[model samples]
Target: MHRCLAVPEIFSEILKDILPSDEPRLNGTLTSDACHLSLEGRPVVESSEELYQTLLALACTCKRFLEPSLDALWRTVDSFWPIFVALGISERDLEEMITRHRNPYYPRRNPYHPHLSDLSEAQFKELALRLIIDADYNKAQYYLSRIRIFKLHAIPSALLWAVGELSRKWGSPLLPNVRELHLTPPLTKDYLIFCGRRLVHVSAPLSADSPSLTTHSYPNFDSIYIPADNTKDTNDVVSSFIKNLPPMRVIDAVGCNSMPGTLEVIAAMSSLRSLSIGKFPDLSSSPAFLSPGRLLPCLQELLIGDIDLDLCTQLLYALEDPSALRQLHVGYLSTTGATLQKFMTTVATRCSPICLTRFTVSSNGPRRSADAELPYSSKIQPIAVQPAALQPLLPFVNLEYLNINVFTFNYDDGFVESIALACPNIVTLCLNEHPEYIKSRNLTLRCLYPLAKYCPRLESLNMGGFTFATGPGKIGVDGLSRTWTHDERYDVVPGLSLHFLNSSQVGVIDRCLVDIAAYLMDIFPKIRYVDYHPLYFHIRDVREPGWNDWK
Candidate 1:
């Protein structure tokens, strides 16, 4: 063996790199919250079995490879098969267990493989009871102790009960060092027993009737993630589930429905620092609470999606003291020019002017050409957003990230000037949502001047609808004679941080590419990537005479 291989720590890390990363999901599909909960029935994909077999073979080949291979193999477990196999449970016994126990809830689709119907609380109970007699305790302890993450979406209740029973018998939790646990629906209080002192993150399904765990069960956990698909989960039930938990720092309930009493319940959780919900409960009907800052006092990050203008406004109003807020992401917004103006006004009034750093809003604009022909589509026209709509947010001078992805805004020089002057610390400014759906706009390449001149730390800029400029006030012009007067400081150097400029969404006429290139290079000296793909533009060929100048 090599000298580096003699070091178990280094070799263990090498082996770990070959294994799958933590919480591998099925079909690469992610939960709405991006929480990692393993799929039911399918734990280890066929692709990974070859690697696991190699590791197993290496472990058996030499004493030097045993510890490291075992460490890498058992670090993150998705199913109970590994544990059962590690405990020296024979295939004959597993087959016998399945044969002996039968449940009416699930159909026996495959007799050879214990399918969904084969797994039930009663069957798991039998397995748990059998484990008490036949489990290889020493071998189980060796492998179970190595598991740091256990993510299983379809866990039988009896399996957890067995672990709890064994934990009580053994005087230690089964997964002693497990830090992250993602369990699916129908969680019981008994499952809390598996959560040891090291557990810090939990993603589980919760419902109103779900058994609640004690706050002290796993006090170390700081983040709790509940999925969006649990139709049975209501705000009241989620609130009840959270109320009993130890002071959590982060709670993500993306796409979860909010009830009348949900806000009060969330407001009372003073320890919460981050919250992500699907919709905002109607604050108008709910009982009035105390002062604004009093609710969600420590919350710093908030994400709300699938919301309308009215609910969005109400939720903003609910946050009185948003001095701690750092990030706000609103998705699927449905609003008009005036409603959007009101929403922005509400945001400026309710949120902390200084604390907010990152802001993103992506609207539910028409995705397809047919969507525009819908009956309700005519009622809400995509009107050009005025400077007044954004005027309210100008107070947030400390903003570093601002992404306004809506079809209503044709980001011209005026809008750029206002934003650049107001939020000089902006790092990323993305104005267009649908780059392919080009709207009629009078904006030209001159819009980039204010951004390059003012926001010195800016890096990424996405002005999707603006066309190349041939008009006056083009770059390198000395006079401030246009409609917008410039300061006396003509010698202000452009920020070198900008490396990405995406103008692929614009539909512009083919013009003098040399002039466009020269103008951009004068102000933005370090722009390395320029995406001028005409998504909605007439010039489809990238190899066109004028387009090659940008390359």
Candidate 2:
């Protein structure tokens, strides 16, 4: 054994790398965001039984590794089973308690909780007390004291009864030092009792019948994550819970429904730094219901998933002082080009330009069947996507990522040039036009010239639909840059950063595949992948020399 192994910092880092933080799991499926609950405390890492045994052996074998080994072993646990096992509870009793308490309300999903018929309230309390009395208190405390993060997947009534009894007996919580807690479905009011004085954050689900948590539950609470509830009319329950909570620093209600005062309740939280909501209620008609308070003064990131143009405009109005905001994302159920233009105009006037960096919006409605398109009115005129729609965003000089997906957009070389000059720091620019609802698109292959010329930092580009320029004369970069500025003419070569080119619905020009490939290579010398439509392959053979040359 080396002397460096005795160093606590080195040993802890090694242990953490070997047993990383536990990835949140919902019925065995991994979530999309691993660090979703990382705002309040450290990530809860699950140490496997085998690793725990190894650490125990090392601790028993050597004095230098004893304290560090024990600390790593009991830092975080996936469930409460290990605590009972450590207290000398028999395996037979544990199995019986779990099997008999399978919840009947959601038998298919939550099979570890009790049904009403299995045990009456008194009977459940009695059994929980017996188990608690039979277990060794000293042994349980030895391990529980070292635990910092705890996750309860399923809470049986008996477990809650036992926890309440233990808290009452000792005059404090069983896990008194825990800082972060995570819970799964079937969440009820009883779970709030576990919020010890030191606890700072909690993550749980919200259901229609679930009870609200009071402000007195935890004195140090700072952040919360309420997973979306699938039940009907859950807004009232969620709103009541939010209304009762103390001022929070972060609130993430991604898939939850919107109520009348939901935004108002959130806007009143002056300390909020990050806020994400599923939708905004339509309050355009009743503007008086909203307060005139300074909303989210410390806000940094705002994400809205599904909203209409009217409510979105109202939300901007609610943000009286948005100078601190950094990111804004808005997704629409459906909207027209005129509405989108008006919304952009509002955003330009409302949101912070200097601090904002990322702006993303999606307006195309949900997918519909082919037969469902009959009711769509052709009387509504089509609007061609122009540089003016994006001109308002040019004030955000620090913008790095811009993504826009709407019904239709007519792309041209001038449109590309406008974006390239407006946001020179942009890293990812995606101008996706909905393929289902096609309109006139005049973009040509020459549009790539401006991107490679002006946006030197750009790495990815997607022009919805485009065609190659046709002519009797040769097509080259020189002809495209004839009107370039004196400063722009210095670096006439392709950009070294761009690697991905996404161009679909490519219309062939004079069957000049060789010239097209050469021109693309000249503009984006570092291109690694080019995405084309299936129809492109049908028009031109995949085995052609032009394609092979590009590869």
Candidate 3:
């Protein structure tokens, strides 16, 4: 028989309010003094702090919260040493670990297999071993058992090995409660395999250089983020880790160009739904690495960068009924207008047109000579670079978001009408961004009115480079509104809600840039924020409901 203690309730009750949640939201504010107002009479404060500090402070209030607060404190740890040190592991122990693994002849074989992960057997043996252990040992083990999330950032490779070996020796998990694991550079997969199904989410900057294991399984890993690593061993690392896993639902391989053949292997997996790759396969160099089997029927989100016409031909030439793909973001290493035309045409002819919901194309703008001059910092006048040929993209009726900002092109003013006609379901539209050109090549604000009239659900629009200077001269409120009035709110957005315009920076405002803050809100009505360049507006007075009346 042993003594037992339990708290009827914990600090979690106290923290329910302060933690981020949907209800009881934090509202915006504005100052009364006119001097404090920066842009269009709104108070602007310049400061920032880590969000968790508030929770940490509140936990310090009650003495009864000591254990509960400690549990919360150790819930999400970045480095393993904090928990290990809190557990009373000595510096000498750490030194011994580094020394042992550095021996070069140290036997790296794992003694205990994956089946030893059973909680009942492992916990009993560890308890029997620690029956007469010190009070400090009890405290250390208690905290180590509470860690729910662990994110290792460039930790010593030997330290990981030590934890793996020491925990296995004691028949307990090194981190018993870890639900998620993020490693900056994982030296080995032994630590991961050791945790078994306790690990739910894992992200690491993985490459071919990490210690490869031929036989291991992580059944519960549903989401994984594998950022690019420029190491030499692409094939072995991907195969060693990926082939043995349970079916994965989400895999993000953005910026992973060096890992050749990795994307195709992931695509073939039956459970794969979301995948993002750094670049499409360069068929000119590695045509043999292409996928020969059935297409990725389950794939829904495919964000591939640095693709050209040749790769477009290789990928979509023979594919059929790829109707499952819903979202796509295709970037380019370099592309010509003609190349884009061929690619789009091929997409229409070869693939299923019904499934697309969101699409984006990024561009590395054409190389300009030194004499290129404009208000743009690089002095390069963005030229209209629309594709030479056009086809009706009306088949993609389910399309909701369309962005082609980076690829510069010039097309007739009717192009917007065509887009509005084809994609009636579109909520966000971002056209190309080109510097102001002569009247002969320019399209005006009035031409976009049809887009507003047709697409009643259009939530956000970016006539990318349609500056006041670029468009038909100086059209303000009436013209900007485009007769778009709905539910007593501006009809520019769907249900009078707008989230983002461009990604970050705003386009040029040639006339009365000072009133832009007030102008955008009045014209769009639902816009809460704007990301314009050369001027940043907090827009507190207009955005916050009663902020102005506060002072």
Candidate 4:
């Protein structure tokens, strides 16, 4: 019945409450800075928890809203429990779900797992049959075919088998034209891989697959995402899947067997381009892993983690003819030794520097432990990056992005001046000290003048503290004194993602004002994003991605 007045307005209002903060974006006017899957700053759909009750009310309100309202409700199903719970099963049968720790779990597993595995196949089928036969719940059955994403992480295989059986009896594939597959432990151990030529993105954990799917190859495989795990399970399933994979470009084995043996298996695949290993917890302590040095020839991007000073030196020396490598994500610690200095020299002299455009050091490792005895003492300390250590990378003038989060705050004005000469092509720069550390009293805007003057291409920057002094005030320029014009100054970017809360004493941001907004914008004319938390400002080239993610 088209009897309700202002239905569209009421419908939009309902959508606002269901969505989290992305309200203005559904119309596609705002930039997609939140998407993590973008390649060249393209906009991708953002998925959040759906408001089931609100959308259901609209579906029942009128025949006109049935299709659109139901589409929004069932467009994405992260798990199977929602469909079952809504099917209005008996209280005793559904009571078992409360035991799972994840109470009212919507998109993920519940906390108190009632162990659905304890149920017999007949018990599972009984519940499945009820859901299929129930007319009220199954009236919107077409929505099942509308499901574009189905995440099977931690979902029981018996339940999947039940759904498959029910779908077969209905004369349709369980999930036809599904676009993405996120596979974790215990996904249908008996059934074969479901066919779907539409699927493009897949995130697979280093776990076992169903027996029938061990040698199965789904259609149109391009990118594979393997999450981090510490288990030493046999890689037979992973090996078989990769062996049968098509000419894929990206493979992320974050915590899987990232040893040389795994790389040996991956290197054989000539189609492989990017290999991300950001979670190798034991990369530093063991010397055996570095031996099979520089194996992947066609590789372009390498993201490694948990490497220390000595291990870094050894790894650099092992990488053979890394001319194709463009992006490097380094995760290691600093030392009082000359390891960093040696690394820069080797990367510039030994390898092809022209292709090395992006270099980043992973931050937020096990934090430095504070000392118990001395109230102000820190148990562990950071070995800060020195200016001299950056000498080797200076020759790589083609460098566009540089991110090192371990540099000390005591950098002199000349440190960045040298950077201006070394890599004038720098576009994105991120240098931050641990937030827990005391803000350097020496950090001043005097150093940043070099980037503004020399590296004209520099657009995006993310760092902890620079110009701790209040503005508009007198600041040194090339050792010369100059007075400016504001009450307070803050270099915090214009994004909610960053933390603007400084210690009471005032670190980089203090007594800030909206008046200085214009002046700061004038300095970085080409900058697309400034992630200074609690105060976000987006400028020209709004299509550019946010501060992180090298690509």
Candidate 5:
């Protein structure tokens, strides 16, 4: 019943189906030879937009294509906002779409519409609410109000007002989640008062004309860091702020100026566990507020920067029971031989037996030149530590860290040996020698050899301003020319000598590594993490004879 058609006949049939039957024909000629050809295989859609246009075109073409095209068009909508604007949709459209399919992705809406800047506030509010309700509440809160996380600069009042209103209405019971809150100048007393109860962590920058916004009932804060920019108003405001704080755990008054009643109030806060006071101008003035006896009884960590040694000793002595003081950091502004010895002796005796886990002291004065000579022996006191004197520090066997700054030393071997013997369990040790002393005569390896012998558990060691030699003959020399040409190889100690590196000089670093590797291969076998600072070379246990392969 069916007859196979030729190619020409098939082409004519396709043209007839595509064009209208009423169309005029050219000379009634059979133009099937000029007809367009269909390619083999399936049709390929170009992109999402092209697919959507194709579906829309199909839907307009005939009733047979309407259902499939509409289905494709609806499924191509990625977000509610785009679909809404595209379809000229309203809030009711959103409601219907959400009701039918409850799993639509809704993007955050921008309150200010770019296309309709002239829209009234009521319209903006309605649109904002609709968008807000569709978005996940947890994510919307970040943009909705209270906390301003981005842009440290000041915020405009309109945005602030909107955020504040939203916060008061919907952000109650739960505090705003912000990492840092900085309240600066130009803010009124009412603004500060309103933010005080909601903010849990705050940094207030005070100015001369700034109002003292200290309220008796303050926010439930856990930490406060105040910056004292050398201003009278700042000092006054800081004092007032501390007076009104809830029982806090940490307070950092690192650079605040000396306030009349500030220190006294801080000392009385029983809940403070850690405190730092740095760069105070007058330590010897003996203000009524400086009472360590009342202040530091329960402190677990205390850091006093750039204070006179005498004042430091006085403060340390004030803490009659320093059992709770586990960490101490002091920066010496004034140091002398007698004062230094007195401070060290006091710590070794009075505070050593307690749980003092870390101790650090630094002198920030300029280093003397290499050519500068040390004071004469007649003016220098003999460096000696009697055995009975060190008995008090035997209780510090549990200490894990120790750092000391030595400006002048007698270069006596016994003194270094005593330190190494006293703190055998130290894991981290930093010994900073004055540059003048390192460059002076009598700087010896014999003095420091005790460290490698005594500190078995030491994981990190820093020795600045010193030279390293290959053999015992050049141990006491000031220059490297005396130590480089030794014939015998040195054994590097493991666990004993694993992480050995010098940040001093190239010649010193190279020679030290050569000797250290030899020592490790010959004497200590468990060494790892050897760093040669000048060469920027690091060697670990995975590679044996690590340095020889390097060109």
Candidate 6:
């Protein structure tokens, strides 16, 4: 009653239900009755092309299968292609795809039935440019153009030059669009010349004779970081670079021995907002940089290291008005008790009323007494404050953050109280590595309750090296003690709390973890994150031969 069907015909019907219809080969082959019968028992197509063929057969059978098959084929494309195949994509197509989406990769084509028409010349050129740079340069360039951030770690000169040339040729006026550029390089001149106008933020280790070094117009640049290794002549080169970059707002010259002339140039840059002279030679010792108020006028944030009170005083006086300086950080510097007292007294009187908002002072110097021979029986004499002391900072009533490190045999409660009184608007306080005098005479948690009561807006408190009250006979307890509990009268301030405890020894670490956990749950319930730096634990499991198997 019916004509016998071939293997191909049977197979065609089965594949129509399983695969999409756009695939061409199977559509043409399955028409014969013998082919249908041959494929009758097969359940699945094994390879991509086989699947594609099956879908093509379905598409030819009915127009309804065409759209779905095309969609499935396009969706499977990804970035990984063989070396030769990636090189084949044309530049124009690549650019078109990149402009439409952040990432673009090619779809697979069968070797026997190649579809080369899809590839464009533009896409190929773009790919070629990237390939010529870093082995991974194509991906890096994609991120740079699309994401606006790039960190080029040790780029080779030849590769850098090639990419620069390609960028110049094809890039739009704002084509590169790089916002942050961190380049550690064996860079060439061409690379720097190409990058100068486009880069807004830059971090690099530069040398005076570096071929990539340039003194050119760079209007958009806002931040620059120079290593402190620059020689005297190199300082001139840096100054020349700075002159070209008028928009620069921040400079970090940590460890760079900047020339005295460079300091003058820095002071002259009215647009400079923040500066760091960390761990450099004492600029204060050089009369050329210190005389006639050689300080950056517009600088709102400053970080200095290994300086002295005289230099500090010089800086305060150099400012058009000390009140305008909002934030200050001094570290690894030494100042005599007399000099420190004088400086503080001056700040209390002058900067107390105006713009200074933050202050941080620290030192690693040895502790000694101003007057060591005085015994417990003698009356303490008030230190005299000179007129020059009053010439420095007026008290800063609007001060928001204050961090002080005092190292001395005698701690003075009056000094701490004075600072707090001067900065009534304080929001954050950090006191650490103080001398024994301060430790012995330090204000207790109960004594500092006034700060919480008065400073309602306070957000963070750091009482460095804090010890809790211990047993009845002991004056101070370990951090775990429950003896020092907050009362109903005390308000719960919403803020971060940090505790530093001894964890170097095994016994200490075990004890500390238990105490720390208990304290966190009971006393400091507001903590958001815990950071533990175990000095004793070496993490032997990571280096073990069978670590992967163990996991």
| TM-scores of all predicted structures | 0.61, 0.64, 0.60, 0.58, 0.54, 0.54
Measured over all alpha carbons after superposition, the RMSD of each candidate to the real structure, in angstroms, is: 9.8, 9.4, 13.3, 11.3, 23.3, 19.3
* Superposition error at 141 for model 2 (Å): 3.8
lDDT of 5 by residue, 379-478 (tens): 2332322334333445676666765545544333465466678777676765554555545323344544555556656655544444444235433423
Q: In candidate 4, what are the lDDT values of residues 1-551, reduced to their tens digit?
A: 67665977886766555533423221112232121112211113354223444555667988766776655554445555544444444433544532321323322332455344444456645655665454342543454555555555444444556556655565545556565666666334332233355555666554454332221345555667765555566445555555555666677654444554455566566656676654344444546646645555566777765556566566666565466678776655445537666766766665567888887654443211111011212423566666677667777778887776563544555777777777877876665666665355354555665665566666565545555453345333334222332212335432212122335434324344332333344444434434443234433223344644457
RMSD of 5: 23.3
Which regions in candidate 6 have their CA more than 4 angstroms from the true location?
1-147, 156-158, 171-175, 186-190, 193-198, 210-216, 227-247, 279-295, 348-354, 364-397, 409-428, 434-462, 467-497, 502-525, 529-551
Clashing pairs in 5: 490-518, 490-519, 491-518, 491-519, 491-520, 492-518, 492-519, 492-520, 493-497
The whole-model lDDT of each prediction reads 0.62, 0.61, 0.52, 0.52, 0.47, 0.46
Tell me which of candidates 4 and 5 scores higher on lDDT: 4
Candidate 2 lDDT, 136-232, residue by residue in tens: 6677777677666667776567767777777677766777777677888655766656557777667787765666544576676667777776656
> Model 6: per-residue lDDT, tens digit, 66-120?
6444333322221212111223434443333333322233243434345343334
Residue 358 accuracy (lDDT) in model 2: 77
lDDT of 3 by residue, 324-403 (tens): 66776676655566666777776566555688887766563211111112222343324346634445355777788876
Residue 231 C-alpha lDDT in model 2:
53
Clashes of each: 0, 4, 7, 20, 9, 43
User: In TM-score terms, which candidate is top?
Assistant: 2
Please list the residue runs of candidate 2 whose C-alpha ends up more than 4 Å from where it truly belongs after superposition: 1-77, 86-129, 132-134, 146-149, 284-293, 306-311, 334-339, 364-384, 395-397, 412-430, 438-551
What C-alpha lDDT, on a 0 to 100 scale, does residue 306 get in candidate 2? 73
Judged by whole-model lDDT over C-alpha atoms, candidate 5 comes out at 0.47
Candidate 1, residues 1-551: lDDT per residue as tens digits? 66544577866675665654555232121221111112322224234566666777878988978876666566666766565555666546644554444545333444665443454557669666676545666877787788777766554455556666777777777778887777875455656666678777778777656665444666666787877664454666676776666666787876576555665667777778888777766555554563334467677888775567766666665665566678887765457787778888878877788889888766742221111211223333455676667888888999988877675565567778889999998877766645445545656666777877777677677665554443654322334323433333435533332222235522232344444555555565445345553321222232243644566
